[model samples]
Target: MKLLTHNMLTSKCLKGVNVGYPLGIVAKDVKVLETEFNSEFVSRIIPKLDWDTLWNAADSIGHAGDLPRAVCDDYENDVEFLKKVHHVLVEVEVIEGELVCPESGRKFSINKGIPNMLLNEDEL
Candidate 1:
């Protein structure tokens, strides 16, 4: 999954999980592919993302590149900053990994870049 997806993923659906946000990543494999950069799209999506989660996820998988810990002031107008954001948010892919819930430690396996978030009946 892309960091954009990771930034929004949550394990709150699990039983007894109050806030299952910012799921931990255990990336056994990661890939960085070239993608077309759209500055406007990156700028528009920035507000919807959790910056810390994105950074941490990228760092965990060693794909953080030059992304900053904090979104800068006037980021929309900053081309270089936007490019960096676009790379992390769009280009990096988790080829094989598991996403762990922070609250419950329940693991969701990612296969071929697709995360299996479906829970067993008991887990739900």
Candidate 2:
């Protein structure tokens, strides 16, 4: 899964989980499959994301590189910053990993860049 998707995923569906957001990542395999960068798209997406969560997620996986810790005052026209955001948002893929819920400690596995978020019968 991309870090962009990880930023929004939550484990709140599980029983007793209040705010199961910002799931913890245990990445066993990480791949940087570079892709075309679109500054406009990145510009639009930055507003929807939680900056801290994105940075933390990337940092956890050791792919943070030189990504800025905070978004600058002027971002849209900043090509370099946008490029870094685009790289982390789309290029980085978790080929094999597990997402752990912050509240219930439930683990969801990711194989081939797909996260299995389905819960067992009793978990729901």
Candidate 3:
């Protein structure tokens, strides 16, 4: 899944898991493919992204250095920043592995670029 998708995901297995968001990426396989840049999209996405979470996810996949500390501040107007955001949000794809929730330790596995978030009946 793209970091854009990851940005919106949070663990829902339990109600009280404070750190449910920002699921830790444990990718056994990953790919980065280039896409056409669109600054408008990046600028619009800045407010929705979690900087720390995106940074950590990018770091896990070896794409961390390009991102700034804040996506909405100094870098918002910078072309380079928008490029980095495009790369992080569009280029990277997780082919396989588990996204472990920081709080509950629930594992959401990704296969063929699709994340399986379905829970057992007990979990619901």
Candidate 4:
């Protein structure tokens, strides 16, 4: 999964969980897939992105120093920033791992880049 998606995901569904955001990345297998950069897509998605959460997830996956706070500030006319965002959001795909929620300790496993967010009956 992209770090962008990971950033938005949280354990808010978990009962009484606190600070469940920025799910801990456990990339048992990771792959960097090349994808065409689309400025419009990046610009559109920027508004929905959480800066802090995206930064934390990128840092966890060893893609730090690319994204800057100002990227969001001047997202309208920043090609470099958009490229970086595109890379973090589209290129880096986590092939396998489990994203654990910090607050509830819920484990969401990812296989072939698909996260299994289904919880057991009790967790539900």
TM-score of each: 0.97, 0.98, 0.89, 0.88
Model 3 lDDT per residue over 1-124, tens place: 9888898898866555765787888998888889999998888888777878888889888887657766555665798879988999889999898888888888999999999888877666
Candidate 2 local lDDT, 1-124, one digit each (tens): 9999999999999999999999999999999998999999999999999999999999999989999999998999999999999999999999999999998889999999999999999988
Taking the tens digit of each residue's C-alpha lDDT, what string does model 1 give over 1-124?
Answer: 9989999899999999999999999999888899999999999999998999999999988888788989999999999999999999989999899999999899999999999999899988
- Winner by lDDT between candidate 4 and candidate 2: 2
Clashes of 3: 0
In candidate 2, stretches whose alpha carbon ends up further than 4 angstroms from where it belongs are none
- Enumerate clash totals for all models, in the order shown: 0, 0, 0, 0
- Among these predicted structures, which one has the highest lDDT? 2
Instruction: Tell me how candidate 3 scores on lDDT.
Output: 0.83
* Candidate 1 least-lDDT 10 residues: 60-69
Global lDDT of each candidate: 0.93, 0.95, 0.83, 0.81
Extract clashing residue pairs from model 3.
none
| lDDT of candidate 4 over 60-87, digit per residue (tens) | 8787656785455677698988898888
- Any residue pairs clashing in model 2, and if so which? none
Question: What is candidate 3's TM-score against the reference?
Answer: 0.89
Give candidate 4's root-mean-square deviation (CA, Å).
1.7
User: 2 or 3, which is superior by lDDT?
Assistant: 2
Sorted by TM-score, highest first, which candidate order results? 2, 1, 3, 4
